[model samples]
Target: ELKVEQNPLFLSMQEGKNYTIYCNYSTTSDRLYWYRQDPGKSLESLFVLLSNGAVKQEGRLMASLDTKARLSTLHITAAVHDLSATYFCAVVDAGNMLTFGGGTRLMVKP
Candidate 1:
């Protein structure tokens, strides 16, 4: 069985600061995805890591995957109030089932 864990669970940061959110899984997976969600909105796909060492970035957000370590990271550069949201990382198992991390709620303070 594949299980996912996210560190911090909640993050509070000041504007212009940088931080990294981590996702660790118990099993092997080649496909990993990152998503963001606002308070009451549906999830929005942010990144897709298709292979080991895959990385994708948009705006001030960057996501990377290391399949060998069963780990993925979402790094926020120069945080801003508009970037406050909940983030999640999901892994696609051999069975093609998607398992998601617990989710990290981020609050960017001004």
Candidate 2:
């Protein structure tokens, strides 16, 4: 089984819209992180999912954690073209190695 994976590798989104991205893992983990990257740009922090029921938001994005099921989620609300970017969710295993999801690329239209 894949340690970490995200669905819909590419997302064609719209301005002033809302969407949800899901991340799944094979085993239980405590540390989860959500990061954003724009085209030709470096990574930026959006939220960090640490434990069960942990939720955080910034700007138009929010993230949640569910350690029991080894799942995390990033939810985007009222997206704008400026929100166009790539989103990644990562989880740290027992060995302290961060395992990254395949990533979701979002393209918001004007």
Candidate 3:
């Protein structure tokens, strides 16, 4: 079975601050993805890290993958109210199914 875990399940930040969210998974897979979701909404794809050392950035958010360690990271830069949301990292199994992390909820207060 695959398991994904995220740290600092809840975060409160001030505007213009930065923080990093960590995701760790059990098992081996090079396919990992990051997503964002708003309250009472579906997830929006943020980054798709297909291999080790793969990194992608959009706006104030960045994501990276390290297949070797079965780890992924989502970095938030210059937090803003609009950026407050839940972030998730998922790992794909051989069957192409994903095991998602518990999710990290970020609240940016101005």
Candidate 4:
């Protein structure tokens, strides 16, 4: 069974600060996806890492994947209050099933 864990499940930071959320999986996976969810809202796709060393960035958010280590990271640069949301990372297993990590709730204070 594949298990996913995210460090620092809750993060509170001030605006203009930078932080990184890490996702680690217990098994091998070729595909990883990062998602964001606001309060009372559905999940929104953030980044997709399809291969080892894949990296994607948009605005203040950057996501990277290291398949060999079964790890993925979501880095937030210059965090703003509007960027406050719950972030999740999901890994696709060999059977094409997605296993999601425990979400990391981020709170940005202005």
Best by lDDT: 1
For residue 45, model 1's alpha carbon misses the true position, in angstroms, by: 0.2
lDDT of each: 0.94, 0.85, 0.92, 0.94
Q: Which regions in candidate 1 have their CA more than 4 angstroms from the true location?
A: none
Q: Write candidate 3's Cα lDDT for 52-109 as tens digits.
A: 8999999998898888888899999999999999998899999999999999999999
TM-score of each: 0.97, 0.92, 0.97, 0.97
Sort every candidate by lDDT, greatest first.
Answer: 1, 4, 3, 2
lDDT for position 6 in model 1: 95
lDDT of 2 by residue, 1-110 (tens): 33899977999987988999999999878788888888788878777777799999888888888888777888889998888789998888888888889889999998
Candidate 3 scores a C-alpha RMSD against the true structure in Å of 0.7
Return the lDDT, model 1, position 98: 91
- Cα lDDT for residue 23, model 4? 97
Compare candidates 1 and 2 on TM-score and give the better one. 1
Candidate 2, RMSD to the unseen true structure: 1.5
Question: Pairs clashing in candidate 2?
Answer: none
User: Which clashing pairs does model 1 show?
Assistant: none
Q: Which wins on lDDT, candidate 3 or candidate 4?
A: 4
* Residues 53-108, model 1: lDDT tens digits: 89899999999988889999999999999999999999999989999999999999
Regions of candidate 4 where Cα sits further than 4 Å from its true position: none
lDDT of model 4, residue 39: 89
Question: What tens digits encode model 4's per-residue C-alpha lDDT throughout 1-110?
Answer: 99999988999999999999999999888889999999899999999899999999999999999888889999999999999899999988999999999999999999
- List clashing residue pairs in candidate 3: none
